[model samples]
Target: MQIGNWKSTPELGPLYRQIREMGLERNIAELDAFGFTVLEPGVAAPMEWVRRLRDRLLDVAHERTGVPHDLEGGAHGQLNTQPHFKHQYILYYLLLEDPIFQQAVCNPHLLALQTYMLGFNCRLSSCTSFVKWRDEEGYGPTLGLHADTPVAHPIPVGKDTHTGNSAFLLTDYTLANGALAMVPGSHRHARQPGRGEGVDAAIPIEAPMGSLVVWNGNMWHGAFPRSEEGLRLVLTMYFNRAYLYPQEDYRRNVTQAILDANPKRLAVLLGLADANMWDSADGPDFRGAFDVLRAAQEEAGLPTTANPYEAQPDETDVQVAAG
Candidate 1:
């Protein structure tokens, strides 16, 4: 299908209304104070769209990364059975080239919510699809309890301030099914806290399918184990102040049509427009890029330009055996 073909549907109305009502400044303040916040129920794209996207992702995984995705068993389970499975880390832009995925990405309500939450000048840093099956067990085991910031690498000290990340659950997020576990307000802590035993301090976000969970990059969080028998799928996208590393090579991946069709804000997120038109610097202005996207989105009548993704449906497709 052509890119952005599904955008004309009426399914996105409620989401747009929600975005219109929410104030951007408030969302950012809440994120700053609590580390994370779950947006109220908003309109979600149809499940068929999500399924199609998943299918396309599996194809990309198999063809480019040699990761086999089992249609019946789910990608995570298949990968766990074979540790050598290689998958794409951030595939949204490529996925968006598909019309269905693009519709979901540009949903005005979701974009508005994302822009508001991240502050007006946010840009898409990374986009990834995570498939955790029953076999994978315990949040990939390798993932540590850490924040996305202070980044996993070394950078100039003050350079850390502009980074942030967000996650969208495309399925119901339950504690037993490897939901994300986080410490509220932990983003304010001076250093990463040790993972302690028990659940008192940890909060597992149990939101309905299609709920969006956004957090600051410094928030102390980690994925929970997938104890359930079915696949726990989620789509995560990170937004930054534009000075941080982007998850995808957006400059190369975006089609010129998308560049032309998209508003100036969306173009910046895709790296189609340069933020520093006035300044002649070899390095891209991460902050300026983010700002341009935010402004363009605002001009387009969106409340916020924050990233948003679909989660799950009301009914469970598969059941997990009790331990």
Candidate 2:
């Protein structure tokens, strides 16, 4: 089927209008040059909403692990039993945990950046949280710097980011509080970092609570060791291009009621608008593909009703197709 016209550059596309409308032109430029950008507090989400998100995450953590957490202090129970990585309590599939997470996934600023990185067909990969504190054996000596798209050998390095990460700071991020460590422009390297490699180049990303730090999928990143006395809370909302498999099975796991509660765009992000493998004789629905295309345009601030799939070919084109 025919497809709609897509602008060659981000600045020339509808997505750029959304970015410009949100005053994120600089952040977009940073992502191009440095492979990452930080959206300060009051830009990503409201401070009150960020606090509520933090509280809800902590409550859910307590419910699952049966350990009350103090964001300003510390917790006693170890939520993660795996010895391979014990520095933080990991909360997975947070989209299923609360409505607040759903709201977070729809954050306009985040959607703008994610759409820019992964395109309009971008779907959510995972929604998780990392609750870190000072470990008895220390947080980390090795930075564990690596690219998110490690599945590819000699990963393609360029402007296209197959995967992207938006980390929402629930608590104040400081060097002492174990802020994320990233190597600037490492996405251009086109390959994963070797063991203990890029340590000297890694720099801590410090920001206030409610801020959002986003990066390219190819960027090499890790975290600094926590020396402070409290928990460092961060909500990680990961995204991937439509062709990539998501870390969580959101398409299969998301309930109809959940889809109904959120905006239509949320359903698109959950992979509902795209056609999937058909098990029945009916086969895949072609409308879903057009719906996804329209949704992409809508999110990019373009006209949603103009579906190229429905456009009829002229007589010359018809004769060409017949030939």
Candidate 3:
């Protein structure tokens, strides 16, 4: 089948105009108010774009990380067996360099949703290229059912607001292939017991390839174990209100050229720009981290943020206590 030009398609033109005009903050707010939203296929990107990304990602994963391109088996079976899979899976930042991936991240609809949930002055917290091999369930028991919020840390004062995560499926998200299961509205609940029943109901986010799913970080969600035979791949990106630490060190990962080219608003999302200062008891200004990054990006050629799959600092880095 011929791949249509998604960017030029009439079906997507309206959304494009909406995103261009609404601004990221307003768009994100709209999505947050609604709980979850999905951008229909061909609106943001064409299926071919996803296919190309998946192909490039597989190459990078194998060349840089040495993960087999065609590994068959569950993530569980690969556990402890493959050294690469032992740690968090491999990630490629260059993926974000792709126009398609950039569009996916800056997609006005998705950004608007994230901004609304996270509050104004939000930025991309992290971006990852994930390939869940067939039957090779090795990436830690499908994520436990929980909101994306930092479970251990209290929310930060002044900056306390809703945050969210979005995943762009590069392949079909089938129930048999470990699709993400989420509890709608669970983000509102404060303390959900581990391995308990009735915390919230799990709903599978099944969708065709190229579809995007954005949800509140507070919403309880996790990946289901795969029972089928094909790679379940996705490129996940997160946007959080300013004043929160990014999942990856954006100052170190993104290219300076990209940073120089980005609008100040987009630069802020990349953590190459700073938001207003807020007094806090949490040691340093806490929010100054982005300033540190912005300066570094200016001095250095570019920043190289780590992949989400990479090892993270402890809970302290991920949590923001509520005031």
lDDT of 3 at 12: 34
Per residue, candidate 2 scores C-alpha lDDT tens digits across 1-323 of: 22234645533366676677789999989998999999999987889999999999889888888889887777734665343357686788899888999999988899889888887667899898887887543435557688888457587645577899989999888888889999999988878888888888999999999999999998999888888788988899999998888888788788889877876678778887666765578866556656866765665466565554466522212221245
lDDT of 3 at 305: 33
80 Cα displacement, candidate 2 (Å): 4.6
Q: Which tens-of-lDDT digit does each residue in 91-205 have in candidate 3? A: 6454355555665676655654565456435667777765665444533453557656654534332223446788888777866777877766555454443664332467778
What is the clash count for each candidate, in the order shown?
16, 0, 37
Model 1 error, position 224 (Å): 1.0
Please give each candidate's TM-score.
0.64, 0.87, 0.65
**Per-residue lDDT for 105-174 in model 1, tens only?**
5555456656544444456776666666654445344334676764543323331235566555666788
Count residue pairs with overlapping backbones in model 3.
37
Report how far off residue 237 is in candidate 2 (Å): 0.5
Best by lDDT: 2
Local lDDT at 71 for model 1: 40
C-alpha RMSD values across all candidates: 14.8, 5.0, 12.0
lDDT of model 3 at residue 132? 67
